[model samples]
Target: MWESKVNIYNVFELRSRTLCYFGVGAINKIKDIASALKKEGRKKIIVVTDEVVYKVTGAWDVIEPALKENGIEWVMYTGVQPNPTVEQIDEATKMGKEIGAEAVIGIGGGSPIDTAKGVAILLEYTDKNATELYEQTFIPERAKPVIAINTTHGTGTEVDRFAVASILTKEYKPALAYDCIYPVYAIDDPALMVSLPHNQTKFTSIDAVNHVTEAATTLAASPYSILLARETIRLISRYLPEALAHPDNLVARYYLLYASTIAGISFDNGLLHYTHALEHPLSAVKPELPHGLGLAMLLPAVVKHIYPAVPEVLADIYEPIVPGLKGIPGEAEKIASGIEKWLFNLGITEKLSDFGFTKNDIPKLVELATTTPSLDLLLSLAPVKATKEVIREIYEDSLNPMS
Candidate 1:
């Protein structure tokens, strides 16, 4: 009898740079972490964070004591802004250089972590400014080591090798993903997250869900990414409400942190699509609007537009949240509506109008979104191809979701 032959041809890869520590007192391990990484003789470091985080959480109180004990001299750069701008990056970089900093430790949410990554890049490519750096006109061969301490369970900037910075002169917020930009290590302490304002908690949780939803439905999604995304969705769906209802609940906070980390990893591997594309322009144009809030407002509209293209993936995404909803007629709309309701229950019922956006702003938003170079790639990965007209329609729908 002749033997049978079989051949398989599927290839995929997942990459993560940060070694993550998660738990109640993970923040206390900063001393040991700094000691281990300091073997390279880089003792002087800069802690990048925002003034609000530094003051409100007293993250510096926890981090500075550890660094002092470890004999790791440090300076502070608390100039990071929400949706960090290139000017902030330049300012922080200049401070880091002035202090003779060797490593950059980010101690806040995405903005500070991203600022640290930008500072790291600029530290190496000393000749480049933020504009040149973001324009990809001067790419550094390597960045100074970055250690991220996450205070928010959003952005996943802690574990991923991507940094989003706004170039205000150009009115663009570009996401820079380079191997060197990844944090050397990440500390995610749920205790740090417990004090988050209720609104911040709600927005960040929704942001994590958006990450998983976009990643799971994108063309780049693999079986591995799907599995992670599924678990992330389930975890956020179950625990976010609990965390909100009982702010002191450590278990809920831990699961929310886990969900954020897993979602970050999944989307870092699979990438995101229209929801991110739409939200970026919203924030770039109106710098005060939080990224997660924009995503929450636009997600349902974007999902409805894309449902015709990736109904199966969308159905699977919602199935974990709304058990037994898949395989039913009009399930996609139901899922989208359910998500909107869930967000509403969490007190995130604001529309674009609440953020100073009107129908008159739609065209400009559509223009900004469509012209974004990265958005072309994101839209390409989206299950549904979004033209400027379609993007405009999504923006219009987002302005009045109930209509």
Candidate 2:
């Protein structure tokens, strides 16, 4: 739990509504969960997923049999693309409406889970569309129950009260955080993640890295967040390479999955700052840019700038990954360089230029970062002031690969 805002009495709130089950064979509980839903009159569910992930992970094998035994049916919507768009949400919402799907089951990573969150909102507010939902024409208080069966060790959308989707026409990506959107149940069965490809395994875990780093240092940070954030980085630093090397290593997958989940929880309580605020616009403009990769490119630059304000927390969080890194004043550049070199070693060597961004693109990126609907809230949480010039410099600093 976390306080909604900083107060004078060192007060904070730590409330998580979702009941999450983490371990191997965790997916086996789907039958019992589905049976309960059926008894509650939610006989049909809307399953949102991408084409490749649901099939590749074989999660459907468990889900299908369980639902059939319980006489529960599902309508599958597999149209979610990376950086999931409003159009995709609308399409899935339409499918869910057609079946009157009472519950939402998101079976992949962030993209599908995000779609499910949108579908749940639109399903409840039949008159509202994706654009209106993003615009907050009506702040949502409730939606159909969502069950997130995670297939990747990233985004933690399953366990957190956050969802993001883009408006293709506007190139606007907005984050949704409401109590109603937290999934009713979350299953983090690392068993499904073992078949994940090497690059995704790297990228997704890096997403978790970005999560804990921001959560531990954001202005809203609390001791609860800091403790879990430290452990998250420690686990990722130790287990990510092993998971990358032995894709079938269940133990490695289990720890990495655990790290991602806790990272999600850390940010859920602590909130986030600059990296996420800026990365959304990058991926929104270029749909093919993966969210984790975008965050990876911006993380070091953000660290360099924000370190002066919260050096101690940043140093401790990053020490496992970048040993001997310190929190000294004016050491921002050295720390930034160290972080860039570390990410470079982790295979995220591409500059913004590699993604077709340039000095000319910086202005547009800044405009989007500042003016987009929900981004300002995140920028406000930065330990350092996230002025336009600072945003510009961070983008500029990321343009060339670290030497």
Candidate 3:
């Protein structure tokens, strides 16, 4: 019935083309995934990661041996920063190009993987630099293949074509998605995620929750995407707290990782909405704020604002998280309130003001959000039309969420 109603529009597409290897020992299969390129005479590869991920997780210890054992020569570009910037992308791209890497292997969370996608984009569009790439001055038709080895259970960059890179000079963060940037393969091993710090795990899990929430509520959501989004929310609601409480619980980590990948696919097809659009400006201006934290802070306001436009959709989404609350009147507000409580329980009770965002910064955030070219698609996909006033109102609400 939901499908019949939603599928009335016959002009949409969904594609999950990434070859995925999931489970306990998926990391060991990297050499097998990379061998496909090596067989085609692509011997050299670049591993894109951050310094913190490299030393903390011992990712290199597992990945390097696999590459060397399989005779795949590789170089390392470990300069990726959180909320990765164009400068970081350019730095990694230059390193990748100088080494003549035929492919890129991303071995961290979303930032490094997204940076790797940017590097792969430049590898093909040799004429374009990171600035031009983020500016949309050049549309790439192809890129060197990428292998994503996910170390965090967030961002789903491992299996999605989308990549978000920040341009600090412009005070903008743009999410770039093209067919060319999709990783050819992905490896999701829960063992790799067992040691994730509580803060990173908490925020990243929230990021996945944000992905599903936005995808399910976006105007572009199809019946299929909603189903996936619903399942993602269910898994996260049940498993994320357990994962946070017991970091070594591989079962919890696996479900969260599974939920994240499903959410990524859901959003990749249905797209995101104003919540993501609003969060981008915050992270772009204050690159230190974790993306999921910003999302958690802004989500309740965005949901409340958009609830009137899609009451049925929000009701369906909330039913799984807060059982027996679906048929009640004002369910949207209840859901919004429930989300705030959940975030507070997870230790994300801080407001935007706590992060140095004063009311004076509202105008700048609104301007950047409204003017950012990359967010046009998501803005259009939002259930409620976000004008400058609406965006400012959301930012103001985020300033004191508890109130």
Candidate 4:
């Protein structure tokens, strides 16, 4: 099977150079690191986060005192939101520059962390501000030191150098641009995830599952990517339900969080497939639906949409991660059906109607989805090439889902 394949440039390559520090039950390392940073005469650290997280999680209380104790002046810009925008980046960058912050700390989920990355990019590179960063201009190499303290176990934004933000002016969808925006420090403490709401936990786990599944099937996927993706899928399949059922089980949460990080690394090294490509526009247009819910609602159909293009590859991958479908046909149609059935068993529904998306919205959504920047990248990886009409058909199919 590997004999006839020939490759031209190493276009589907994944590379990152960052020091990784991993351990079990190390949530409080953020404080210890902060104290060390302060002792080293690092002052004027800016913490970019959201108001709810800063107050509710008491992240500000722990990190703030640590910085203050070392005589480091600190400031905060907590206005970042879900699917962060360029305006927020501009505002935060200006604030960071004004305060002369030598370092930046992100203390929440993907949103605030991603927002901090965007701000850091603007601060280091573009003088035209955040709006210009979206225009595809020259990017700088150096950014202020960024410390990512991940409170959410899902988005592995801490390790990756890419920061995605939704720019409404650019068609009201998420725009992904990469730069040297990696965090100087990454702190992953599952303890922070202890207080997470049950729904949020389940939903975010679904998002991580989407990451692994999509990467396992996309164009940039490799043997390493496939292996990592499969392991992540298996771990999630085994651990997500357990974590959901026993929310306080440290062992389950630890594995789930570990799975989430691995999934993030996999997708960051690989690339997201159709589901992530489709969900961005829906979130851009809807904004009411949580990102995880949007993914859960759309992932099954997206899987079906791409399955016909690469059935055998997908079936072989799924055989190990998902049980009960091992003996089925490996053709595209049966593979798609098997994946659909598995998703249904996993309690993920296919209907957009359940989430309030109507038939009337299909055309616009199709147009939006087909035009999304991620579409070409995702489609190139798919087993099948999806045209506008095919995209429309998928959207229509998503309207009435399996009841």
Candidate with top TM-score is: 2
For candidate 4, write residues 1-403 as lDDT tens digits. 2112323343666655444445454645666777767767677877899888766655565667667667778778989887787788888888888888778888888889888887777667646676666544555577777788776667778777767667677545544536477787887766667677777787788788788778766767666566666677777778877777887777777877787788777777777756776777777776666777778776656666666554444555566444444323344445445555655665665467877788888777877776755455665666457676766666666666533
- lDDT tens digits by residue: candidate 2, 79-113: 99989998899999999999989999998999999
RMSD in angstroms, all models?
A: 3.9, 2.5, 1.6, 3.1
Model 3, 1-403: lDDT tens digits are: 2343464655777878898898988887876875677688888988899877766666567777767766888789888888999999888888888989899989899999999999999988877899889889878889999988898987988888899999898889988989888888898888889889998898888888888778877777887788887888888888988998899999999999999998889888888888889999999999999998888889888887787767666667666666665433366577678778878887889889889999999999999888886887788888788788888988888898744
Better of 1 and 4 by lDDT: 1
Task: Give the runs in model 3 whose Cα sits over 4 Å from its true position.
Answer: 1-7, 327-329
**Candidate 4 global lDDT:** 0.69
lDDT of 2 at 373: 88
Candidate 2: C-alpha lDDT:
0.89
Error of 2 at 385 (Å): 1.2
TM-score of each: 0.94, 0.97, 0.96, 0.87
lDDT of 1 by residue, 1-403 (tens): 0001111233556877788988889988787787785678888888899888866665667777777777888778888888999899999989888888889999889899999999999988888888778767765779999999999987888989888888776678777878898888899999888789888898888889889888877777776677777888888888988999998899999999999999999888888888898888888888998889999999888877777666666667666565665443366577678777777877889999888899999988888887764666777878777788889988988886563
Query: Which residue pairs clash within candidate 1?
Result: none
Model number with the top lDDT: 2
**In model 3, what are the clashing residue pairs, if there are any?**
none
Write down the TM-score for model 1. 0.94
lDDT of 3: 0.84
